[model samples]
Target: MSHNAASEPDHHPVSTAENWWVFRGPADLPPPPSWRGIAGPAGTPVAQEYLLSPEDVAVVNTALHLRRPLLVTGRPGTGKSSLAHAVAKDLGLGEVLRWPVNSRSTLEDALCRYDAVGRLREVSLERERRSPRGASGRLRYRSRGRHSDIGDFLRLGPLGTALAARDRPRVLLIDELDKADIDLPNDLLVVLEEAQFEIPELARLPEDQQNVEVLVTGSRERVPVSRGTVTCDNFPVVVMTSNGERDFPPAFLRRCVRLDLQDPGEEKLRDIVRLHLGDDALAEAEDLVQDFLQRAATQTLATDQLLAAVHLRITGADLSRDQLINTVMRRLDEAFPA
Candidate 1:
């Protein structure tokens, strides 16, 4: 079914069995309504809630023992990224520190970013707000050697935050490393091996101002920095994901534990469906699962596409199940008629 405009959402939890082919749009747009493919619940499962294969479990444990990044390579929808969350959940680590890599990503950007311009502007404004000019037409701050703390201008990125001293290890997810600039993987070798990074701004601070509280990327919480350097008390568990976009340098590959995710089988797919949708929907939806498996043999179809198709199926769709499957399972290159 074709919808005129996206319908508004309700606050209640999405029931596995929502009535579909029913109107959700404006009063003018009635009956045989479009599918609500985008209407899933808001948040994803945490680390503890995720499912991991035994092979994946073995490789992840190896990386944990060796203290190396686990590099995950897979096709789209193969759970390459979710592996990080599963590991964090299983280990009871706090929120995963995620660094999403792209073409512009760099090692320095990952470690820390100092906003000098923003700092200069704020400092100038702060001086005026705090104290008025004296007879010499110069501002006089109250008993000041350094007017504002340098730590205020500095913030650590995800990598840097993971490296900061903490009671326990943080789980760091470096997502899509293959999408990063060519040198990024190689540049990561030192940080991965050393588990430490220095903030030059804090490093050069006067001895008296050496210890400062600074901001980190994800938590946005300030942590104490000593002598401008950060060293992990516990080495972080690192997971890096890739879509098989490109090859990594041999030296870079040598340092990382690799895990390659394959598409889930029929049994695993049914289990996944049961986990996400519900047992109520699984019986009828299993029919689509077989259809999806058939198409997946000839063309690439992500697990998510199957989920979306199933999500619509469980809803009381006016359209026949076969029609809905044919419409939703189109190849990536297949185009819909205008």
Candidate 2:
């Protein structure tokens, strides 16, 4: 049954001003300048170098020197998460092993995941492939209970992969730890100090099968795990970001080096602008940057908001200041000043 074109409903009549959308059907835009879209030839994030304050640099270095996790706390868009990317990129560490935390996230989930059901299914299939049941003595004799390879059913997560990397330290970004369960921070203390984790699935294997090769999160290649234990030769650079939403346990906080990313100053803001938007956009950006700075003082505003407005303005969007305010430069709290 063929349907007429008019039979289908329109999606809000294609908007009153189609050109208002930067994501229209014909005018697809690339990713934002501040974003890293994909992996490069070197198998790392496509991020450019980012600036950090002198104090932040010192604190990061202290964490590296002490072989402790760097706990970065700050407001939104203050570069807490960006610090991990910058460190990983500048240090020639391969792709960062990022563990995005949430209220339901578990330590086991970040370490590794085992597909028990998949392994069981594989074993059942193997059993089915045996000679037909009750046909002959051979049929019944061939059906001994045997399991599939456990390695095929297990994959190491980001945290596990970082601890397993032996050549050099990989950067482990534990983003938004404040959103994690209250117990999570304390749970991480032992792992951060030990730099190793044991996989009980592999541990319970036969004495002869002490070692297994398993897949890791970001790579297809399997890494050899001896005695079911993955230990790092060098401590990984662990960076945990918090948005000042919660306080961690004293024990957890004691093991970490703390760094607070303050709001970028005028000089730092200009550098960030130049780095992301480039020199071509800089000439027309000063006034807008000034406007953003002034507004930031009065209300909660992020640096990205300024970048967005500047991006639209320089693109010849013909938007008025009032329009920009109502749309792009709205306060992070979603309200205008009194």
Candidate 3:
């Protein structure tokens, strides 16, 4: 439905099946209320709780306002990644840029690659073949070293995308930074501090296009990033997550706003299940989910296992309880063998 500020009250709350829509401002065009605390689909509304506390919200808000990176630490399945998406949605920004970290990851892995050398070779070969001597001229072709046009192929990486965003700040999710190598985080400190990165390839390009975009993430890998060395002058919002594996360098910790995540309570879980699964299966799924969680708590079952059981319990054939349990167990066993 269209919202006009002139027609509607300054704050009019409309209830829908999923969530409430709040409108504010002028008649011609009214800006939708920020979805900071609200939960639902990207633009559509859905009923979901902000499981984070007020203090946590303040920390996040401060990070966003100042464009500083906010580091979030918590156990697995605590919705750390989801927060990035939420921030983008709340600000009416589009999709988020996600950078998944791994052990072998490097700065080059996250930045653009220049293929100028390859292109130059192809062009030289083509010219030789079309010369007066035809294929025979190919033998006379000089072996001039390939020139690198770093600017042309210097495409933006996840971090680059975040820093270069001009229209609106884009949400960036750097998942599992701990897995990355030592130099990766150190290399990132330069861009994170300056809010600008120079692509060696692009440096030769026109001044306007020489800069690269950037956003970075880190985990409990404990790589050292020295202080007073690099600072984010542009201030892009940064979010980091840790699985409580190890402590980060003190210097890195001092620069960030950290927050912990708590497991969802029954109410919040119910809301999440309903939001994703629907109302009809909420009751049955909750029971199965709780049982799965109980088992998981004692062992080290992945979150996907619990979700699988819930799915089977709600959507599987109308079998006896024992049969259903057997099906779930079999699936879990296949997914995670002892």
- Top-TM-score candidate index: 2
* Model 1 TM-score relative to the real fold: 0.80
Best by lDDT: 2
Q: After superposition, which runs of candidate 1 have C-alpha atoms over 4 Å from their true positions? A: 1-48, 134-148, 318-323, 326-328, 333-338
Q: After best superposition, candidate 1 residue 106: deviation in angstroms? A: 1.1
Which residue pairs come into collision in candidate 2? none
Error of 2 at 334 (Å): 2.5
Between candidates 1 and 3, which one is better according to lDDT? 1
Q: What's model 3's lDDT at 71?
A: 76
33-83, model 1: which lDDT tens digit per residue?
A: 122222225333322234567667788789889998899998878777777
Write model 2 residue lDDT over 1-338, tens digit each, in one string. 11111122111112223354565444445344334345666555565556776666888889989989999998888878778888887787867789999999999998889999999998787766664764354555454655458898899999888888878889999999999998888888788777789999998898999989888887687889988888878788999999999888888889999998888789778776666666656677778888888988878788778777777666655477778766888888765559
Candidate 3's TM-score: 0.64
Tens digit of per-residue lDDT, candidate 3, span 185-256: 657665676665545544454555434332232211111112211222234456766666666676766666
lDDT of each: 0.74, 0.78, 0.54
Please give the lDDT score for candidate 3: 0.54
User: CA shift at 57, candidate 1, in angstroms?
Assistant: 1.5
- Backbone collision count in every prediction? 2, 0, 12
